[model samples]
Target chain A: MMKVVKRTYMGLIFLFLYAPIAVLIAFSFNSSKSRSQWGGFTFDWYLDMIGDRQIREALTFTIVIALLSTLISTLAGTVSAIGIHYMGRGVRTAVLNVNNLPVLNPDIITGVALMTLFISSGLPLGAVAMLIAHVVFSTPYVILSVLPKLRQMNRYTAEAAMDLGATPAMALRKVILPEISPGIISGALMAFTMSIDDFVISFFTAGTDATNLSILIYSMAKRGVKPSINALSTVMFVTVVILLFIINRKSEKGEELML
Target chain B: MRMLAWPYVAWMGLFVIIPLVLVLLYSFTSGDIHDMTTWRFTLDNFARFNEPIYIKVMADSFLLAVASTLICLVLGYPVAMIIARADLRYRNLLLMFFLVPIWMNFLLRTYAWMSLLSPNGLINRLLLSVGLPKLEIMPGQGAVLLGMVYNFLPFMVLPIYSVLSKIDRHLLEAASDLGANRFLTFWKVIFPLSIPGVISGITMVFMPAVSTFVISALLGGGKTPLIGDLIEQQFMSDRNWHFGSSLSIILMAVILLSMAVMSRIDANQPVEGRRAA
Candidate 1:
């Protein structure tokens, strides 16, 4: 009786989890784009997505920003994590807590405040402003992800490298980086996905012509619900699933790389 | 690591502190953009509190956030339990389900809902065809809550899942052997152990929902202006930074107070996990 109840509960939970995405995937493929009559199965939307010029551009921009933001923020967050990881536990915790302030603060605060600062400083909202805002948002997450690994690692290995006459930089490069590489990679992935996924903050910070995929989607929505966006969604959805599959497989292989 | 210290100091100062100080200053000083730098610190920005509308919006935003948090917690708890306790084979896929939506572009997900829920959209159309009541759901408070809940569900899930993975199964077995039934065993053994996750998830949902702009803007159909929407409009369109700053300051106070209350509750409960204590 208990087993039955537990199974039913778990089934309901899975249903809740997958229902929306299932609905989305189904609708994207539905032949009747007018409403969702399911007239027939059609791959026409996915084919149309291939030629959607604005969507292509938006995706290109989104990927570019994601990569750029991830790379820079990874560099910064890794540095911060290593720095705090080495500090006395008390001081490290304090600095780490302060670094997490951005997460606790609302995005409106971050968005409007950053926009105000940049505009006030006469800094045009271009690549620089958007990248800065992305980095700001991404850094804390990377730190949060990596800091646990830093905390858990046996530090004596790095100490041994240092005592064996390697410089601190060399020890980090030769030993520490290899050990913590998984955390760093996952952190970078988190940063990349998050930057691309970001909408509100990016919309506020981005100006004139420098819109990411998210903003492009919003702009499209404001204009009208184009059936083409369904095509675009189908494309993005497919790519995301493929990407998730690849990442999981890679992680499974433990493809550890330094830098 | 020592070398890293300098750059972090530089990074935090340039990006975090200066921007934060500027916002703080804006909150205190006069509101007009023309005299932004000059200060005759006035409470007038905060004085806008006399209007009941602003307060109403704040309360509504808070209520929506709280309700969403509650729903996510109740729903996420069991899903997280299964993900944590499942056979190792499908664990990755189940976890991927949680991560995929979160990692997917937020605008796409929100807009996808727009298409799904619109008056002439798929959902409404389906209901009409099935001879059910043709319900309007794409606009207003209901729509905003839907978007907020959809977007926020993962935030609640991730934290709870992380916590669940660390819970000891032996504890549950022990509770059952002590003569507690399955429900009582779960209630006494599992629930208390996961309070930290619940607290963190609450913070995650409440913080974002309290200030969600894009979801509210897209789904509210201009019927409601959330605190986030109001602050955003005040700064950009209204060009009333003074008023915006004051609103921001008040909102910040509310957020801090909410967090304080959450932490106090967390502290009051005797922590079951070593780390939580």
Candidate 2:
């Protein structure tokens, strides 16, 4: 009886979580334009998604921003984490507390803060400002992920390398970097996901010419979302599933190495 | 390594520190948009909350946020416990299921609910087909509360599951050996141990729920306006930067106060990994 109850409860929650997503995917194949009724099954919306110019442009911006932000923030955050790991206790705490603000504060506040900064600094609110905002929010995640790995490392590995003939830079490159590579990779992946998934900050910072998929979706939602959005979301869902599958396999291999 | 850190220090100073300071500056001054010459430092923007309507909005946001957090805790605790105690074969897969929805664009997911809850949407159609009355819950407070629970459920579940799965089984056995029943064991042993996760989850769910404009706008219709909506309106619609910044500061203060409360509850345990809000 207890087992039955647990299974039933799980099923109900699962239904609650996935029903809307299922409706969305079903509507993507829907021949009708109306979201409420399914006329029939068709692939026209998927094809239309490709042909839609605004969507194509938004998709381009989304991908480009996610990639650039991931790359830049990962590099910067990894370096900062290493530096932070070596700092004196007080300075490290203060810096980390500051770093945690963007992560801890509500996204809306962060968005407004960045918006204020750009307007006051005279930076035009376009691709540059949007990218800056993405980097600002994303780098902290990278730092958060990377710092844990840094703490777990064998502190003597880099020191041992330096004790030999290697210079400090060379020791860092040859020893510490490899040890913390997992954290860097995970941080980069998270940064990419955040950059892609972000809406609020992007909504505030993006200018007329520079819009990502989230911003595009928000505008469409207000005016009523189109069937093409269903198609877009389906594609995004599939991509994430495949990406997670690949990452899962790689992490399993990492576990095997540890064992 | 220290040299490598310099760039991040510079980046944080420019992007993180200065931007927040700018919000503070904007919050304290008036005539921000109108007159460049007659800038006056004022607290009227903060004082605006004294109005009954604004107070109601803040109160409503708080009540709804609290309700959602409580609902999440109730629903999430059992699910987390089940997953934690489930067979090893299914554990990661189940955890992935909870997390995957979070990976989807948050706006898209909320939009999905918007359509699903509309008068003639899929859910209503299903109800009608089954000879049941259609729910008129959309575009109201109930719908808003449901949206909050749905979106933030995983936030509650993940943290509790992390803590639950890590708990030493011997403690539960020892409780049983001491003649305590299952319910007693749970209350005395498992529940107390899970407080850190509970605290973290509550803050995680509460912070976002209180500040969310998108969920409220889409699900609650225009009837319910959260602090987030007020802030957005100030910037986007009203073009009142001073008022918006003041509201933002107030929102920050509330969240910080809650964080302080959470830290006081579990002074020793650091919220890390997936629990790192």
Candidate 3:
């Protein structure tokens, strides 16, 4: 009886969570444009979504900005994590507190602050501004992700490599880099996710000419129902599920090997 | 390595520090952002915010955020407990269900709710089919609150689940061994230990709920305007940077004040638990 109750409770919560998504996926294939009624299945929405130029541009911008920000932040964050790891306690603490500002503050504050900065500084609020904003918010996350691995690392590994006649630069390249590669990869993944998933910050910074997928969605959502958005959601949801499944499988295998 | 950090430090200073300073500067001065000569130091922006309508928005934002956080706690706690106590093989799978929705774009997720709750949308259709009255919740505080809970439920559950799962089994055993019933064991042993997670979860849910314009904008149907909407308007439409900056400052103060209170509560918990034990 207790087990049954627990299962039912879990089922209800999952239902609440998935009901909207299920409705969305179902509506994407509906031949009817009305949201409330389904009039047989069709693939027209998917085709329409693909044919839409604005959505295509938004998708392109989303992926490109995500890629660029992830690359820049990962490189800068990994280096800074190394630097921060070697800093004196006082400076490290202060820098870390500063780093947490973007992470801790509300997204709107960060968005508005950056928007204020760009406007005041005479910087054009477009793709470049959006890229800069993405990097600013994402780099701290990478630093946070990489810093843990740096702490876990054996401090003397690089020094030992140096003692064996390796130059400081060579030791860093061969020893420290490889040791923290996992952190770097995960940090890069995080930065990419953050950049891609961002809406509030992007909304403020993207300006008139640059609209990412999220900005496009927000505007469309506000204007009322769009069947194309439902289609887009289905595609993105499926893609995310597949990616997460692969990641989960790989991580499970890693655990098995460790065991 | 220290030298390697300079570039990032410069970036942060330029992007993070300077922007915030600019906001602070704007909050205190009325000006054209492009031209410095027109800038005049004044408290008029904040004084404008002293109006009753602005205060009501702040109060409503606070109330709605608190309500959402409370709802999340009530609904999420059991979900967390169940997941934590689940068999090891299923734990990750169950947790993944919670995370997948979050990984979906937040706006899309809220938009999903909009379709479900709209007057002519799925829920009303279902209700009509069932010979029931239509449930009209969209474009209102109810919808906004629902959106907040739906979106933030995972934030509440994940933290509590992590804390609950890490709790020492031996402690529960000892509680049961000491003439305590299952309920008492949970109350005395498990609940107290999970307070930190609860505090963090509350902070996580409340902060975003209070500051989000998207959920309220999309789900609230322009009827329910939170402080976020006001801030967005000030910046995006009103083009009143001074008033916006002042609103942002107040929002920051509210968040910081709440966090300080939460941390104080968190700090005091262990001692109280020890005494009770």
For candidate 2 chain A, which ten residues in a row score worst on lDDT?
A: A250-259
Q: What lDDT tens digits, residue by residue, belong to model 1 across residues B1-277? A: 6557668767777777777777777777784565665677877777777789987888888898888888878877777877887776667677886677665567767776776678877678779889998768668888888888888888898888888788877887888889999789778778888888889998988888888878887887767888888888987788877678777877888899999999998888774453632
TM-score on 0 to 1 scale for chain A of candidate 2? 0.95
TM-score, one value per model: 0.90, 0.95, 0.98
DockQ of 3: 0.86
Q: Write the per-residue lDDT of candidate 2 for residues A91-170, one digit (tens) a residue.
A: 88888998998899899999988888888778988899999999999999999999999999999888888889899889
Predicted complex 1: DockQ: 0.51
Pairs of residues clashing in candidate 1: B31-B242
Error of 1 at A246 (Å): 3.4
lDDT tens per residue, model 1, A21-138: 6666776676776644566788777776778777788788888889999999898898888987888877777777778877778888888778888887889986789899999989
CAPRI quality band, candidate 3: high
Which candidate has the highest lDDT of all?
Answer: 3
Q: What local lDDT score does residue A117 receive in model 2, on the 0 to 100 scale?
A: 83
Candidate 2 error regions (>4 Å): A250-259, B34-37, B267-277
What's the TM-score of chain B for every model shown? 0.93, 0.92, 0.96
The number of the candidate with the highest TM-score is 3
